[model samples]
Target: MMQLENLQPYAIVEDGPFLRIIFDHSYISLLVDEKSYQFIPAESSEIFINKELNKVHNLFDVFTFEKGEEILHVTVIDLMHMKQFRTQLQQIIHTFYEKRTMIPVAEVETIVQELEKENILRLIDRAIDEGEEHSFLELTNRLSEYGGKVEE
Candidate 1:
């Protein structure tokens, strides 16, 4: 089991139509919470690089604008080239986290204040996870038993 601590943080960026991800080491797998993503090599890059590498001749890298239906994949990149172009996303993530620590007290307070607004979202997600398994009456009754107001 890996804690979020086990994985370095990264920021994904795009330039024109190309998406690049830089990671500490060559290890990276894109995902959303539990789902994992695989890499889709660019068609042009694939066709051009086929003479140099055999694996990417016909693979289609997926792109879409849908929720919960996103593709997850492992992307192998030339570390040297991407490093010359941009820092590894993992390094960028680490740097972002690092910069936050140097923030002044007032800025930290502002960040925390904004984070509190996200707590409601967490509560709603919790309700959804638990709501599916229990009847409305049962859940409402349980909530009342625990001194919480419930509304349908």
Candidate 2:
């Protein structure tokens, strides 16, 4: 199957109440409305173009034309759809950054547990130096709970 890529728009002209999208061989005339849209294929008598337009569910949709084995795809998008897409893209980027900067609760809890273990070790050392039996036993118990061993 033959396919064409990067088909640039030739021109967009306002013809009466309709907007015309001009390509190299064919053109599409659109009568846009707030509630619905009317797409009319002009400058070409290919029935496939009309069939493709009939398949369009939205105002901004892709139309495909097939002549024998060679197929051409055309994208039709209005300015309003472009702006809406831009806004949606911006929102996606913003949400991505926001989630990236946020620290997970599990990670924060792990960090706090590590710091608590370090503090317990320091207190145990202080207890050993001062010869405090009660404090040394309590700190060693806490260290054992944290999966750390205190040498007797």
Candidate 3:
């Protein structure tokens, strides 16, 4: 029996020769024969499934198996879980977009400070060439405040 709460959002789509169930970060493909079904996962996807859903015994756990049945079936519970999972995924994606649209203030401040330090260094170099002792000393002091070193 599969637990509904642990289910993640997925979509079934036709690949060239197989049907693929794609999840947000991974996928499993199914190849059906006359009497049996084969579940296959790409190398990376197998690793992800193993790491994320440790309780999964096989990739076909998404489908229900009954005694004396050769083919796997999707139960009504599976559809309900998929719907709920899709809604949860939609909410999470919306939240991510909202956060991404906000300004990154700290990164902007760091870039501004780096530009200011470079400008001060250039001014200090100009003061040195012009033999302006007071300006050179003042620029050097300001550079020190930014934790920048003047290389000889």
Could you list the CA RMSD of all candidates, in the order they appear?
Answer: 19.5, 16.3, 12.2
Could you tell me which residue pairs clash in candidate 2?
none
Regions more than 4 Å wrong, model 1: 1-102, 132-152
TM-score of 1: 0.19
Q: TM-score: which is higher, 2 or 3? A: 2
- Give the Å error, residue 71, model 1: 70
Ranking by lDDT: 3, 2, 1
Question: Candidate 2's residue-wise lDDT over 90-146, tens digit each?
Answer: 443345447657999999999999999999999999999999999999999989999
Kindly list the per-residue Cα lDDT of model 3 for residues 1-152, writing each as its tens digit: 33223333354343343333345432222223423332222221211122233222233434433224453565333433555544554454445446656779898899999999999999999999999999999999999999999999
What residue pairs clash in candidate 1, if any at all?
22-89, 37-72, 37-73, 38-72, 38-73, 38-74, 39-73, 40-61
Give stretches of model 3 more than 4 Å off: 1-101
TM-score of each: 0.19, 0.37, 0.35
How many pairs collide in each candidate, listed in order?
8, 0, 0
Please give the RMSD of candidate 2 to the true structure.
16.3
lDDT of 1 by residue, 1-152 (tens): 11121233233333344333323321333334554443333221111113232122223433221124564332233322244212443454445546755869899877765565354345545667777534544555545544455445
**Could you tell me the lDDT of residue 15 within candidate 1?**
33
Ranking 1 against 3 by TM-score, winner: 3
lDDT of 3: 0.51
